[model samples]
Target: MTSTARILIVEDEPKLVELLTLYLEAAGYACHAVYDGNHVDEALTSFKPDLMLLDLMLPGKDGLTICKELRQHSQLPVIMVTAKVEEIDRLLGLELGADDYLCKPYSPREVVARVKAVLRRYQPQAPAAASTTSGVHIDETRFLAQLDGVTLDLTPVEFRLFALMTHSPGQVFSRDQLLTLIYDDHRIVTDRTVDSHIKNLRKKLEAVRPEQEVIRSIYGVGYKFEEGSV
Candidate 1:
């Protein structure tokens, strides 16, 4: 069984907050609840939660401001919760470095699932030798994949995709499999989503190293990483 993870619930709605706290505790997570945005700094300093479930609409300071402040100091995973379902709001949260977002009227179980997924991505792993033979070093500690001394600034999704593929070079993984690995709730995702993320990741990689195309797409199949290539 996985150990209990600490989570902070930063929502203003009392009833919803209680529901979330109860559900998270039942799911074997240690939870700390705060109702006002003004208390975020203090809670962050004291609670030191593994993940934060932040609501966009708060009483004092608004979620976006708090998110920006937190990102300046720490890369701690944050999942934004908002009553607004607009695409702009979602994009803004993602751009501000949120690991994930949950729209309001959501299931507590789904929230727990997302928290677990984000934790898995950000959690530290033991040191391992790089598989790349070209002196490329992959540092899981800093969430970086470097080749020939050039580092790639990958998003959370991109990093996870790269890590999984590099672990088993030359082995193909279907879109469904990759989706399940990256996201906890794969039931709602389509193959197109995976394709889009892969495209974006490739662009990021190409930005740093024009010649390196580690991830390869198989016609009518899926994607795989080249052997000995990081």
Candidate 2:
């Protein structure tokens, strides 16, 4: 069994914070709860949580600011909790480096599941023997994607999605499959989410290499990375 992971909960509401803490601890994970934005930096440095559950509206500093700040220093996974239903808010959080977001009135069990899923994706481990010889170079160390001297500045999600496709080029992945790969809790995602990310990834790739498109969209199925060429 995997060891218990450390988590930090940053929600201002005493009742909700306490509830989540209780649920997470019951799940056999180490958890720290903070009720203000002022303590976030200190908690991040000292607690060193594997993942953070941040609420958007907080006293002192807002969650978006904290998310942006954390991204500058660490790739520690973050899941934003917000009561806001605006799509703009959701897009802003994701664009600012949050791995996921949970709307208000969420189940503690669902939150726990999301946490586990995110950790599974972002946590690093020793590479498998076969992966080393797969001829697909995904340099986690450099946060870079390269093929025949071409390089791209892929977002964390984009990089992961690209790596998945490139590892087995020509293998088509349905929208549902891509959603599962990109999000820890696929239960909260939609097919349009996959479409948006793919569009973003394509735009980023096109910025770097104007002549080529590495990802291709199928009319009725999904997407596949073009194979047989660099």
Candidate 3:
């Protein structure tokens, strides 16, 4: 993540905002803050932050609703911070298009790390390092993807994740590692967001080659791709 990256902190507690600002600023992020959910949009427009650290329970509007509405037009990465530990709340937040969620009573350092992780993922980097993997080929220059000579329609995230795993066939990539392969550290997400991406990518691969299992999930580990002997 760039040191010039801007961060918007949304929370009701003044002390928490101060604490976060202290840590985030030290980590080289410029931060703007809002105490109520109602002020989120105005701040978003004016601040134009690269990422947002949103508190789930706010005085007005609330995080889930704000997130849902934001997803309608913005791709800004949001990391929801909340005290709610319920499984449903986490699922709801993810469903609402939050990039990641952070449970409250969290560490300031972890918050900074999450901020870096999400921003790193959000920012566009150079194209895939390696192009071809067996029958699957990616034309980074033309931005084309093909599975066994058939064009594959994939989202950008799916494309990058696909490129990473296929580039290193048979090598394992844990969820976090896959999220930021360009880096060795940084926990991008706590949940199985990576699994959902892998699932979608597998479906696409399945459509072209029904009998071949190109992507393999290792139990209790992570995911890897197999070229399956030319």
Candidate 4:
């Protein structure tokens, strides 16, 4: 498909932004740039980019703060770019609602590919009737999930994992397998990243049904969904 998708690059490094813009534009996307975190809102309102490539640290507002605030009003897909390699940093970024994460020294081409993957998966599909199975209900068109009829505020990545695991019930999905489903770019994201997602997913699920632990870790193997007895 010929893409006219708009992207906002939020990076303090001018050269990096230029490189990303070069690659993204080459990949058939239109790109705008914000050099500092403070200017993100202005760009979002004026440029109306379909996606944002956000830097973790900046002069004014940090990426995490911006992401948390943005999620309050918008569900625009986000891919966090950061220099920090710590797993906790990655978890925080994801927990703050980032769609994907990229550590620094990343390939611009790969970033472009990730942008395409996230955008492709995130595109709204035809509204389907909410289907309830195994005690969970998800609306594809709405990108909404409900447990015990309580709405879940799930990120795209979280939603995909929840739906896949819930659909299979008892099937154990290894980290690699789960990563393949959530992140299509085939990049090297750490195990903690996967754990972070599972942790967040469980929290959201438990919020709705506090007594039941639907998703259980299988130690060294992976994780699976089990409809616990109530």
lDDT of 2 by residue, 103-209 (tens): 88889999989888887776566653332312346776556676545676566787788888887788899998898888746476567778878888888667656
Give the TM-score of each candidate: 0.77, 0.85, 0.66, 0.90
- In model 1, residue pairs whose N, Cα or C atoms come closer than 3 Å (at least 3 residues apart or on different chains), thus clashing, are none
| lDDT (Cα, tens digit) per residue for candidate 4, span 51-89 | 999998898999888999999888899988778777445
Give the per-residue Cα lDDT of candidate 3 at 15: 96
Q: Model 2 segments beyond 4 Å from truth?
A: 92-94, 128-136, 140-144, 147-153, 184-188
Per-residue C-alpha lDDT of model 3 across residues 67-106, encoded as one tens digit per residue:
8888777767788877966743445424465666778799
TM-score of 4: 0.90
Best by TM-score: 4
Give me the displacement of residue 184 in model 4, in angstroms. 1.0
Sorted by TM-score, highest first, which candidate order results? 4, 2, 1, 3
Which of the two candidates, 1 or 2, achieves a greater TM-score against the reference?
2
TM-score of candidate 3 versus the correct structure, residues matched by position = 0.66
lDDT of each: 0.78, 0.78, 0.77, 0.83
Write the number of the candidate with greater TM-score, choosing between 2 and 4: 4
RMSD of each: 3.5, 3.1, 4.9, 2.1
Error of 2 at 118 (Å): 1.5
